[model samples]
Target: MFQYYCGLRSGVKPNPSSKRSSFAHKISRFLKCCIYFFMSCIVFHGIIVLYGAPLIESVLETFLFAVLLSTFTTLNCLCMLGPNIQAWIRVFSKNGAMSIWDNSLQITTMCSIVGAWLGAFPIPLDWDRPWQVWPISCSLGATFGYVAGLIIAPLWIYWNRKQLTYKSR
Candidate 1:
C-alpha cells in the first residue's frame, strides 16, 4: 500500500504536462510585460498631466502605482486564466482581428475609462469633505466600472454569441 501510494510499483515516473511553459519562458515573458507596463504608465501619466487633472507633489509616484491597478484590471479582463499580453496589444492595432473575448475586453476597458472620468464629477459638489482629492474619485470610478464590466461581460458574450456574424478580412 505504501509503495503504491509512493508510486514505486513498476518503474513509473510522473511527467509534467506539455501545455505548461517553462519557468524561464514565463519569466522572460513577464519581463517583457514589465517593460510594457512602464511604458504605458508614462503614456497614461503624460495624458493625465496634459489634461490638467492635478499637480501632486508625487504625481509621478502616484501614476507609477496607479498604472499597476489599470494594467491589472485590463489584463485580467482580457485573459483571466492565462494572460495574453499580445492579445491585449492586438486590440489597439489597426485592422485588428476581433474575438468575443477581445470585443468584451475592449468595451470593458473603454467603459472603465469613461467611468473613471465620470467619477470626478462628484468631487466639485457642495459636500466639502476629506475624500475629494484629485484622481481618487477617478480611481474609484474606474474600479466600479471594471466591476460592472466584469458582471456584464458574460451576459454580453452569451447573448451575442449566436448573433455574431463573420466578415471577410
Candidate 2:
C-alpha cells in the first residue's frame, strides 16, 4: 500500500544503485506533498469564504471544511502523482489516453466536487438535522464521493480496460 501510494506501479525493487538515491527520492516526495497540501488548504479556505460561507461567523468551521475537502481532493492526487504538473494536466485534460491510476484520480476528483455540490442541498431544507451545519454536509458528501470513486473508478476502468491502451504517436 505504501509503495502503491508513492506512485510505484510495479513490484520492482527500488533502484539498488544507491541507498542515498532511494532516501532522497522519499524525502523529495514528502516535501512536495506537504507544500502542495498546505497551499491547497489555503486556497480552499479562501474559496469557501468567498462563496458566502461566513468568513467571520464560522471561520474555524470553514477552515476545517476546507481542510477536509482538500484532503479528499488533493491528498490522493499528491500521493499518486507527487506534484508532477505535466502528469496532472495530462490526466485531467480529457485526453484519450489514461492508465487505470489516471482514470481513478480523475474520477475521484470529479466525484468530490459533485459530492460537495450535492451536499449543499440539505442546507436550505426544513429537516434541520444536526449535520445540516455549514460545511458538515458538504464534507460528508465529499468524503462519501471520494469513497464511491475509489470503488467505482477501478471497476469502470477494469470494464473498459481495453479502450485505455493506445500506441504512442
Q: How well is each residue in 51-136 modelled by candidate 1, as lDDT tens digits?
A: 66665785864595358456745455424423465765675455453676666666677667777778878878888776677667
| Worst-scoring 10-residue span by lDDT in model 2 | 160-169
- In candidate 2, stretches whose alpha carbon ends up further than 4 angstroms from where it belongs are 1-22, 167-169
| Candidate 2 collision pairs | none
TM-score of 2: 0.81
Which lDDT value does model 1 have at 166?
A: 53
Range of the 10 consecutive residues with the lowest summed lDDT in candidate 1: 13-22
Candidate 1 local Cα displacement, residue 46, angstroms? 1.4
lDDT of 2: 0.83
Residue-wise C-alpha lDDT for candidate 2, range 1-169, written one tens digit per residue: 8876444568665565555777888899899889989999999999878777888989899889888888988998898888887877887886733677888888898898788878888988899899998988889888888889888898988887777765232
